[model samples]
Target chain A: MAETVLSSGEKIFILHGIDADFRNDGRRRCEYRSMEIETKLMPQTHGSARLHIGNTDILVGIKVELDIPHADKPNEGKLEFFVDCSATATPAFEGKGGDDLATEISNVLIAAYQTRNAFDLKTLCILPHKKCWKIYVDVLILQCGGNLFDAVGIAVKAALNSTEIPKITAATLDGGEPDIELSDDCIQLDTSNYPIIITLCKIGDNYIVDPTLEEEVCSTSSIVMSVLPNGKISSVVKLGCGSIQFNTFTKMLQMGEIIGLKLNKTLMDVLKEENQFGRQRRIFGFLK
Target chain B: MPVDQRRINGPEVSVPYHIYSDFNKKSDKVKHDFSKRSDKRIDSEIRKIFLKTGIVSQAKGSAYIEMGNTKVVCSVFDPRELSNKNGYCMQGEIYCEFKFAPFSCQKRKIHQQNAEEKQYSLILQRALEPAVCLHEFPNFQVDVYVMVLDNAGSSLAAAIMAASTALANAGVPMFGLVTASTIGIYGNHYLMDPTDTEEAICNTQPDNEDDFNHGIITLASLPQHNQISEVFLIGSIDTNTIKQATEILTAANKDICPVLQQCLVKTIMKLHNEKK
Candidate 1:
């Protein structure tokens, strides 16, 4: 991960701040930074969204393509997660330097969405054992403030929500071959059950949500948990060099569930409010 | 027939895709018109540029430049201790990395840097080395990274301009600033700062073997030094046409040099005021 070196004293100050239930930005341990989201910004893609959480800016674009379903799972579609860490975020991510981190984040996303109830791939199936909608969720990290996984997950959800898949109007068998026709109407995806990840960084004895670069440097370990809207934990992954006891790990998981639920609720509310604006929603990409 | 397990599989859709057909129709309609480009700019006019410095707070210096829809961000890191040591070295090394975002182009780019990106990195390094005073930072290395947010056209030229401005913003000693611009030659007409579509149309080779008068020329130069640092040409064109294109690119670079100077001045003034 791209990070800054924090001195011991600075680390102690952050630990003390967390112990008091207050962070450097004057927020509670569970509080999150203000986020700005805009959807359908990239006209080229079927669905696109730009998200800013503090300084970690992410752009997610979803492209839907037609492909043959797997033989084992002929009725299900496919979801692919691709993460590109832009060199502008840090010099450490230049060229192939960021590939390892990108693969790690993408793997976590794939695992999060792999659950049966997390995302229904059957809805994307156009025809059994034939054509299906393959959704490609490409995430671009323009800047890294901290807490990248959570930011990427939220942006992916927003993009997937805004995605409009072309409706198949007609399918027929002509001369022993299947033929498909696409309609002008595009159907908006139902992303209500999409999973959102929340990363809790352990600083000293307590865990904090949304660790900044300095706080991340001071953290010994972090737990990333993906929570669905129905309060189901889809996946869990631990990062950093620090180890946690089994009891502490269980507590961390519980804390993750609580914070993840809150984050999802707020995210849904924000998306709902933005949708109410309809076509009048202003798009401010990186210009802002 | 056996399935190819090595390649990622997808749902098989019918032929004659609607999206591709729509794009083809749109382009076919524009192929005949030669009066002006699609964006309503004349043959010689360049797109409007929006340039800013110090956009990345973490980097020592950074710049973001947008030419119409083309967006490029370049960041310069502070001088760091060189990892490779081979005897005594007098001049510092400069490393350049160029990348295009997955969704920057019409087609989605992969996470890894492709062959074209690596080639552009080499070109950028050559373009920037002429301007930087490398000997000042002995036993250290400075890294410049350029990311293309949106690739409309003239991305290399835009990267060159952004990287040079970012170096100046970082307070790196340099002989002069480098400005760059690209021109597309189609038949007898020269298109300045062509967009992606225009570039494709210009670069497309005709089926007939007799007619081959299309190419793209990118020129990076120091206007004060009156010397060209790098020239990247693709496709095929006559020598005379190449000369004409170079002149046009040089003039465009001259036009853009003042804008770059103004941007650097604004960044320096901001830094100076912050110091107070």
Candidate 2:
């Protein structure tokens, strides 16, 4: 008896529709809802972005704080992802209800951004072993439209691209305590080569990308594919119940590859264009 | 785009950005120095308060308030079911959550509720409990979520005003409207309705962090009965300042009583018109 109580008849009807290769909303297996993206809404943070895909509103903010690099990876900076499903969105996420979902999403993000191929971490290191910047990419889920994986990934990447880490004017070693001066104007972090996630929902016969909530309920299985900008799979893991056949899984990988490449190109173009027209970024927050 | 309120600044050599690396001391001073304005008023002077009702199209009843820099949006959720396993429905429950958007301050915060937010939420719960009619809606809970979009200062007091407004908005029966405000004590001067930059901080760093503890007072009142619904204190302050702030805040909040009542009156009138 989950909170979402879809009738048995409705569930059956959804399954039947999936068999015929069409969803209830008349969307093809590979269609997404309308998406709107806005960046730098939070003037207090280093970088911030909010994305609304249907009713699902996701906000991602990145803060660059000085810290010592990892003992194992001294030359590389650090990136940590934390997701909070606030109760303002839904009562279901009250108290500790959203912890499991937060952990799942954060774990996936950590795995996806593990390698330099997906995201460059070395540039974050200010000095060899002394100090580096740890970018905390915190995601707040204001609404729970389905296909959260894709929405979060897209928002995180956009926020990262919009992140302006203050340029270090000078770093001097004086009497064991290092003194670092930051530039007046904050400089945008170079994340033009970040990764994007594509979720493939295994409907009855066909695989759907970016499935809606109603569609998510009908699907038997789904796989979240984190596709990097270099046209390689960063991580591929299955989610939800049921299983996909080997042949269909391979086909999804292929479809994901094609979609992934196109997605990367368009995303970069949007980000670059948004940055180019920067002065006009008048933040219209939720009030509007 | 509400283009009128925005300030688009060009590049500058010295922005006077205040960095707060240490705790127990008030943060740095930025552009919005209320004390040095043309009025020559001290920082503690509260702005003229106003309350409007029946503004929200969707809510049953509603009220809007402005207190200098602290702009809060509050909506009363429900006199609905108590979903949690643990519940004593004899008296209604009051749930208060205080949130400050990352962009609400000069420094952009990561999109997470830090420890301070939790403390604020608890403070809200304490301040609001007295005003809410907990026994009226038993076997139910009312939720108040205060969203601070643009935090200029004294958000907690604003939150109290918001909760009362939201309760009226939801058509929930209540004892009376409540108004709240904060008073700041700096040096020999006292300030009312301190902004985010002035939140419980010393103007200068102390030789010992524990030495300088400026006093802060938060007060919420029900005007008709002269009932003090909520009161909270933070930092350090002398007895005279506390007594003075209470008097000033009570006087100010008493004036706001009609604004909240007007909302309820409008809501009642609207319902009556609908019935007719």
Candidate 3:
């Protein structure tokens, strides 16, 4: 990506403002822009969600398929994540141009879900060594304005929360041949307590919660932290070319832990309240 | 399309309102029994149709079509130049991607263009070929991305409807409004706008895989001139049944033309109203 040059005076002004704990947009250090979340937006996916955080828009769809487990992990289920940085996000992402970013973000997801506490691989199991449910989480990037890691993580959690799985009625095996029957009624899984991601951007002397594109350009380094319901850190990824001091890294970790706890609680509350409100809640998706 | 008379074992198979199958043999059996005309529908009957536009505002043109429970959404993009050298075609191009949302049916599958979606794209290209003025832009291509929100039945037909509406919404020059719908025969009865369930019932029987031979007729028309652009039939429909289904589809499109044109006019008016 080509860099946009800023006048020396403008750079100095922004740097000075940051030093004084003020942003050009008049937002405080920890404040975030308004966001919108819509669940079950794409009817085709078992669970789908669309989230817009500022100018960054992310859509995540969770598809469930039955598959035979790997030889090494026959008893445990599997989770795979694929990210597509669509051209709609920016002209620069046209064609295969978005592959690099897609890989980077998906790697972050892999790390986040790698830990056992973050996602229970056993919950996706169907049969001991025969069949297991594989969830393919496909994230489609529609737009980008910055702080994408936090937005994408939040959207993935929401999409997983809204996912509904078909109830398997019976699975019979005769002579090592299996026949599967599905129940007529559908069942929804509880994902309200799913993991939440807290991306801490190390700015001048402080670590900001979420950074806009401009703020991202100014930051030297950032850490993306994924936290599960029990306050356990699932994954922590450091980004940017700037080196981080040991003291700053520890401080950022503390900040992430505090923020992650609050984020998980708030997300659960919102999802529960929305579910309790049910269909009466006005449906707002892409149209809105 | 003639439904391959296959067993209805898939959890997605439905038989409540609409039945799927080739209608010739079943209609023949029903006709032999003579229990008054099945369906009690008029010769010019049409399935219940509903359309929603501006559903995907991010796209330049978008529309959603629902024929009974069969629902499809299409997004239209470009007269823009092809970004890739290999992705271009001579007579203007129509790049279509169709996918069934994992939750759209009983079994949730990964997101990819499946064999079924590929088949539909070819059929849709055939249906819209005559209606679209592809010669206008020789090197440019129009991409249509259709996602099946629900798979009750007739998704291709609904996709056709959605695509046409999206083109109009995009202000693409067209001869006129194009609407496509499917009609089928079950036993001795001719059913209009069969749902996925109805489609299944039409395509099945108690014993064998007879529904595979069931005939399905899909008709796309300009509706104003009574000119048919595409008429597809699967299974075996004798000359008379074909004529009957064609007449039914043609007349239904004829009736819907004004309504469809009125929608276009209303949308245009809204655009102008906003400008003013």
Candidate 4:
């Protein structure tokens, strides 16, 4: 939890603006700031993407390794998420200061992708109980303006879209052991049903989406909802140290669903349009 | 002269022996009858709850609760100076530890905290943070520990209820009492305080592709204030079910408030009799 000390006057000003449905920025109550996404930035990893929402910057890299499947879930592969909060983001994240927030974010991402509709883990399985591909998703938080959950979710989906899993040429059982072969060809993973998270911050009697760093300090509580592309919510978790009335909670959920669906469509269109360029897309890196 | 290092030191993998018993075969992947549960309870009926406070003599406050086969015990320690001084703070903090006995579940649990337990601890803290008045003891910390002796299902919900009662028994200042409930949704059926088998079935992917919405939701709310302290939902559920589940859970939470109040009243009466 990064703290930005604000005078009582400053807090009142922000709260009043939100109560009137006008944010400090020129966005509406349900509007999000402009976002920029770039994929395939790291050549060494199987997939990589960088996402920027205002000053909040996140980098996601994915790697695949051959491994055995779990005993109970032998038919499905594994997806592990690790989040690293860089000290450069804020001094508060130094050492183990960010472990709590990092674990919370990673666990939420895992829950969002746990369902079959959101992500079909069976696709990553190579063998029934012997061999499978384990996908490791590492998220690096380079900066945190606000709305870290949504930014991380969108970046993860983009990185998964660009991932290329090498094809298996042949497989055979050699006595007790199994033999497998690989080819140069690679196949892309399916990311159509992936979910995008939308966070709604409750300020005063009204709830707003995508609160800025300063505005985050003014809100009482916020809810994070991960909505699938098909308009179904995968998971929801209430954050912040505040209580919410029953009616207000339901209203926030409804608002979150609407905003999440819109965000998903926009992100998919952007990713599809980028795919059309097919390696010809310009690499912007960190530069503007 | 060298030992056989190639051969594994132990079996490649060890599994529980109960999986081979006849009991497991009888109910393997059977399409659950939504009308009546295994315990003969209706879909919306929760199991009988037995709640008591002041179970631990040494702790400042303690409570133990049982909902059918699930048993949870919570203890709250006194407020002490913050161990890790991170600058000056105006409000107090809470440290929560949630654990399960090795034999609590069907499978054995290790002594070290697992990822699932860690997440539960964090969720417990969030659920209780708003209900407890932390400003009363600034720059100090209150430690709350919850251990599940038997986890049939809905362990987190049971822990939340017990911990709140323990906090109150400790005589700590608080805004209002908190209670929690869990609901398992399978298709259109909403099973209140589901059992272990029911929870597993609901959590699994829907067999027929026609139905895709199923999962669990645990909600903790402050009934006196008419506000929800925490709402945690998992699995893929549509918005309509979410709305229904929230309503049902809120009512369920309110129903348990009177029971807790009765328990607290009984405890006070016993103390008064001893003092006289």
Candidate 5:
């Protein structure tokens, strides 16, 4: 992640701005930075999306493969998350410097999507215990501005929505030997229930959403909440060295749920519109 | 059961079915004519090169280059104090890190730098070190990071070209611009700037024992100085054939020099206009 060195005066300014519910960029406390998303950009992957939220750029590619289901959950598929913080983001992320942050982000994603309400793993099952579709959601962090969790969550949701898993045409157990045939038609994954993470950075006495790099420096602690479209909180992780009161933690959770639901709705609507436009939609990856 | 936590779980090992099928279909579609290459390019014709500098605002100098489908972005940060400064050295150090995006190639690249990427990074550093005047900033190191957004072919050559432009754009003192190109030799025919498909075809093991002259030769040269900085050759090839390939590669590098110079000039002009 890229770090911004801010003076005491600058930090105080950001804290006061957050306390007043007016950020430096004039965004409201819960307002998000304008984001741009393009799906199906990487033709190499089964499903791919490039998202730009402020300066935090993320590219999510979902690759689907057939594999045996877990013994405990023989009928369900697997959704694995891999986050790669590229060295291009910053010199600090060179070599193994970014692996810790990458693992933390990926673990949050895995925990958020673990529940059945958030994501139905069984939907990816091919033939009960025999075979299942393993969805590898690989997230590549190109640049880090701030609010990386929110940006990565949104990108993952959009990528999953655009994912087209191959439809199974035939499956049979002939003479005790399993046989399967895949069709040309691809089935789009159901992402309506997908969860989006909302990171609320605690600045002063108030918590702000989508903190920029400068604002992030002023914040003492942050809470990351993954909320589904149904307003269900899937997971919550507290970050930073600062601690908060019990009441403030609950308040943050409530705020995250409300904002996360709204965010998910808007994301789905945008994704639907893009799909409707189909080939006519302009795709601006890094070129823009 | 105790979990083995020493090693992280890597990607699954399986054939990329979609890419394999697509590759087979594409190769089957192409006529197995030895004389004519795919994409209708002559044996010595290179792909169209698009190069630009100063793409990354945060970095001191950056460049973006697209050779057909292969897109590589290189950024050079300002020289910083060396962390392991045991003793003062006369010349500065250059650190190059090369990475291919997970979705860049037909197969998904892991997050970590694999052996091939590490090798490419060293190759790029060797190619650019000769062009830079390192002694100007002693006890400091300049970092050059190159990311391949898309890998069609000749990505190493593209990375070298992009890094040199980026270093120059950063106002780093340099002797001259460095340009690179890759040539694939299949039997007696030499293909310039072979695409991924073409390279794959040329790399396939020949069934006939006599047709053993298949390989890729990447040449990085200082065009103004008329010097070859680095030569990377993969696969087996006879000495005479390598000599011919080097000639073609050197000629290709000469042709690419002007493009690099033009891109650097444009970047400078843009900066000047912005200042005004």
Candidate 6:
């Protein structure tokens, strides 16, 4: 999260700009900032992606391990989200200062992926009740300009798209205990149903998507929604310390649904196009 | 040598006995009768509520509420100077702690707050922040603690209502009183103020691909101001359900406002009589 102290004049200027459907960066109300996405950059992780939107930057890495399934959910695998706000993102985030924001973002992600339609955990299950694959999605906030949730959401989906889960070659029950063997073959996950988040910041009488840091300071409240590719909303959370009329809240939900579907379609297309290049594509690290 | 000696510890891999019991296999899986609940309440009918104020003497203000089986007690303390190492702020802050007793739920809760409890605390703080007049108590912080003695369903909504009353009881200035309600949506049925069982069922993924909406929504609103303070929705639900759920929840909030106002009035009357 980025923090800024604005004077009365500056606040009014930004508010008026939003009211007239023009943001500080000249983008329309619903238009998002152009994002740059790179996948499979880190060799240590099973899947890795970096996304940059305006000044906000997020890096997502996914690690998969074999573990026992939960007692209640024996047939399903687990998806755990852990967010680490690096000190480089902001000085205030140093030394456990960002725990609250980290928890909130991770909780939202967990709720977004909770539904089976969004991301099926059954596909990750190796053996029912005995063994399963635990996919750990770790998000690192390298920089925070504004709209951290949406940036992280995009990065996570891209990373999951590039993930290659090692396929099981053989399995058998030996002496009432399950024994499994792994092959060199790997299978890609079905990321088509993955959900992406859309954040709408209510400024003045209008709502804007992907507000910058200065614009975020002028807003009263914002809504963060996770929408699947099928246009179904998985979860919605209202953020900030302000309230809005019930009428405006419903309007925001509808707007978010439309924007989320467009963003999901665009992101999937981008990932698919990138995948077509295969391993021949040059990897882009932090360097230009 | 690394073990903690302060308290007793259970086995490393202790499984609940109910998991092994055969009694729950068949009977528990029986599809619930959507027509009538176990308590014979209709789908749209909420459970009876009992609201009271000034329950705790040690705190500045307190309130206790019960909705069917869920019981929650909330207390608010006087504003204290901000203790964190932050710069001067224009608006005061509110610190909310939401806790559940070990025996509050069917499964025993731990001493420390879990992830779900932490999320609930954050939501509770956000829901109450908009209703409070923080500018009046600038440079200070008000602490609110909510304890769930028994959780049957809609505990978060219950906590929100109780905390709002506690804040009002402490004479915190506000634009309007805050009221909250929860709903469980399953396909076409909207179960207002769902019980623990119904809430679980609604939150799960649909067994068949009927494309029906399902989810749980918890909303807090300021009735007099015509504003929604917080909305926490979980599960895959469509926009239509959200539109309908909000309307129903808004009406539910309005209905409970009068009950809260009456309780507050009674508390004030007793205080005035005692002063005489």
Pick by TM-score: which candidate is best? 6
lDDT of 6 at B273: 100
Question: Over the stretch A106-178, how does candidate 5's per-residue lDDT look in tens digits?
Answer: 8668757865656777788877768899999999999999999999999999999999998889988767666
**Candidate 3 ranges with C-alpha deviation above 4 Å:** A1-5, B1-276
Q: What TM-score does chain A reach in every model?
A: 0.97, 0.93, 0.93, 0.98, 0.97, 0.98
The sequence of per-residue lDDT tens digits that candidate 1 reaches over residues A109-224 is: 87578645567688888887788899999999999999999999999999998899998899777775668999899999888778898888888988888889889999866777
> Per-prediction DockQ, in order?
0.01, 0.01, 0.01, 0.49, 0.01, 0.57
The lowest-lDDT stretch of 10 consecutive residues in candidate 3 chain A is A238-247
Poorest 10 consecutive residues by lDDT, candidate 2 chain A:
A240-249
Question: lDDT per residue, candidate 3, B73-166, as tens digits?
Answer: 9999867776665445556666667788877865564455544565566556655655677777777878888889989777777888888888
Better of 1 and 5 by lDDT: 5
All candidates' chain B TM-scores are 0.90, 0.75, 0.77, 0.92, 0.92, 0.93
Candidate 1 regions off by >4 Å?
A: B1-276
In angstroms, what RMSD does candidate 2 have relative to the true structure?
20.4
Specify the poorest-scoring 10-residue window by lDDT in model 1 chain B.
B1-10
Alpha-carbon deviation at B105 in model 2, angstroms: 44
TM-score, candidate 1, is 0.53
* DockQ versus reference, model 1: 0.01
For model 1, the TM-score of its B chain against the native B chain is 0.90
Error of 6 at A7 (Å): 1.3
Cα RMSD (Å) between model 4 and the true structure?
3.8
lDDT per residue, candidate 3, A27-133, as tens digits?
Answer: 76666777788888776899988889888899999998999876434567888888888888887688877765776577667656654445657777777678888
Q: Better model by lDDT, 1 or 4?
A: 4
Tens digits of per-residue lDDT for model 4, B188-219: 88999989888888777764473478889999
TM-score of each: 0.53, 0.51, 0.50, 0.96, 0.53, 0.97
